[model samples]
Target: MNKSLLKLTFTFVALLFGLNTFAQDDFQGKAYYMSKTTMDMDQWGGREMSPDQKKRIEERMKSFLEKEYILTFNKSESIYKEDEKLEAPGSGRGWGGFASSFTGGPKYKNVKDQELLQDQEFFGKQFLIKDALKPLEWKMGTETKQIGQYTCFKATATKVVDEFDWRSMRRRQPPPKKKDSSETGDSAKADSDDPMNEIEVPKTIEVVAWYTPQIPINQGPDDYWGLPGLILEVNADRTTILCTKIVMNPEEKEDIDKPKKGDEVTQAEYNDIVTKKMTEMREMYSGRGRRN
Candidate 1:
């Protein structure tokens, strides 16, 4: 072959080889999640409300409880977020409203590094919570279930959590017990301890998850992860997050960037900061109401 023709042929062959290699190492994938939150609003006046009123409340709550999320992940890292208002079929940015403040935020997890970065917003303040991934002592089970054509295995874990335990926070103040002559030192010491303090401590929450080894990725939505495979369903504290769809290696892979712009704090620190600010706001509004 002539020199010019040989050069052209070599370039074409190289391009084909590059494309073939790209096809082999797929790497990137996206998982769509839909979260369902079942609320028992008894303390919030659910018991007093009529059936019609309850139905109307439930209808209004559909938008808040049923949320769509997308997790774009590779071998070691993944970004999980809520679907934007007008996101295309598979694309979404998970920044949500006030409801999300009490639950979660846009999280980026690197399983290999055991690191997590979350973009959290409370009221109007933005927070970038950087923390180690929450550890779960997952007990893998032998049971199997089908989740969207994928065979998934059951796993259970117990987590110490306080975020969703509203019942403990609402325990009726115990009535004063008459002091007995025999009940002096230890019993008095117990009474001196505040009941609210005990309830405020974190309690153990059971987490049930189903994962599929077919995907060969250690990833899941929110703080639930560290499984042997990709998690398809998670039931935690009366909330369920299910993976509805999965797409691998799209035509154009979008860049997954770490969130940077916000007040940097650990997950616990952020929660404390938010809780303090909210308490202050509530006290301020209550004061205004009294004056009015």
Candidate 2:
């Protein structure tokens, strides 16, 4: 072959080999992330619950959350999927009392936690930002860590609220109820009560995510993503999901396919469910407290 032809032939061979290597590389395409969580009862406002109660609550929470997630990425597309399951608010005396009052005055009593658990189901979805691949401002952080043999980087995010998130809601600020003249003295004392003022100061939450570049897959336990590597530690909302095991590029290449067309709920909708339930719960507790 002539010099130029030989050069072209060499280049073509190199390209073919590079493409083959890329296709077979364990860390190149898609990955799966899973974790087991042991949320602290006190951390989640279940401080009043006994250890056994907390254990039951945790089991229910974990079972509801137990899911398989798939992440897919290539030069052209990216996608995600959560194995679907039915979920409902877990039940206990506290949750039951709250639900009973809010749904109307005691249509039910001593409801089994299992029966209550069937009322709802919530999960995350595939997020397709127009340019999800073109990197944005995200740092896996400076903290060095190891999840299994893979060394990881840390990342953090923060949120702050000066007032209750629902303070601006019209329904939240109800017109003062008219007090009967016969109960004026007691009503006057009740009117002076302020429950909002009793809330403990919101504590600052810092999340430290451990990502391993070895994995080369930007994925995490939930909606968290866009890190330089697979996230091994996820701390948010006072709850943490740590990766106890991470196996990269196993002998058998597992296919990770993204959910197609209508498999999961939007993040906004999920937020609404949680907000509504929490509001209902608060209202239930509020009505049970005797006016001072």
Candidate 3:
């Protein structure tokens, strides 16, 4: 073959190889996910403020999810109600019925959003397949049981801690001024810059996922994708997200949408809110029984 013809042939071969590789690794399936995490606070830590706490927690989770992933069919409704009018044997007005009963259908969060959460300007984007194989070189550990459906593979990731860093891209917080000052003064602001006090990094986060090659879509329940099949489980840091139910091509067809335009906020802002709430929760529990 001539030089130009040989070059063209090689390029075409490479393109075909890339497409086939992607198709082979893709797993397309539906998953019902539930994220269970240890409460940042104790029982009395705002989580026990009647049934209202549940809704608040759900909202917080939703907001956190908004940082990454495009949610689909995300709906919730109260299913349980109490008739407060009924008189109890000992209570005077009787206890009001709790509205805790609730059920919602499957919610789809696209893998693309996961990267966006790490950085906002990266919206409506996709990551290269090779990026998924980056080193830390964490190992893919043993398989464990999940939802009694399939054995899960474990993956670990870690990063060196960076102090004084900010999440301005992940949230919608106001920009920091060159000479910003709060009523508390510089000392308070300085304290927030210390990363050692916040937590350590190279922190090990464990992820468990079940990939079934039967489906050929490159996607998972949450921010997890790139596996050979659908990811049925994913656990990161204090959170454990799992697939409770799986429906392979259900009768209904629907398109999932990403959080866009007005729905999106700056990353810094979201982090500020989360950090403030976390601090409040920590203080409430840590200062219990200690009078001011």
Overall lDDT per candidate, in order of appearance: 0.73, 0.44, 0.38
Descending-TM-score candidate ranking: 1, 2, 3
After the best TM-score superposition of candidate 1, give how far the Cα of residue 234 lies from its true spot, in angstroms: 0.5
Q: What is the TM-score of each candidate against the true structure?
A: 0.74, 0.44, 0.40
Alpha-carbon runs more than 4 Å astray in model 1? 1-26, 86-96, 162-202, 285-292
Please give the range of 10 consecutive residues that has the lowest summed lDDT in model 1. Answer: 87-96
By lDDT: ranked, best first: 1, 2, 3
Residue-by-residue lDDT tens digits, candidate 2, 51-141: 8987787765554333444444332223444434445655334443333222211010111111100012322322211111222245434
Scored against the true structure, residue 267 in model 1 reaches a CA lDDT of: 72
Winner by TM-score between candidate 3 and candidate 1: 1
lDDT of each residue in 68-170, candidate 1, tens digit only: 9999998788999888565443222232244566656678999989999988777777789899887799998757778997778789999887553332244
Residue 266 lDDT in candidate 3:
39
Q: Candidate 1 — which pairs collide?
A: 82-94
Q: What is the lDDT of candidate 2?
A: 0.44
Where in model 3 is the C-alpha error above 4 Å?
A: 1-28, 40-138, 142-146, 159-206, 263-292
| Candidate 2: stretches off by over 4 Å | 1-32, 36-62, 65-140, 159-204, 244-292
lDDT measured at residue 279 in model 2 versus the true structure, 0 to 100: 67
Q: What is the C-alpha lDDT profile of model 3 across 1-292, one tens digit per residue?
A: 7865664454356446534544532222345666544434332245556667765554544423222222222111001111123343443211111101111112223333333322222223221111121223344444434455553444554532222122111212234755655536445544444322444333234454554433333355534555534456656555566656655434663444322333233344544544665576566644452332
Query: What's model 3's lDDT at 4?
Result: 52
Candidate 2 local Cα displacement, residue 229, angstroms: 2.7
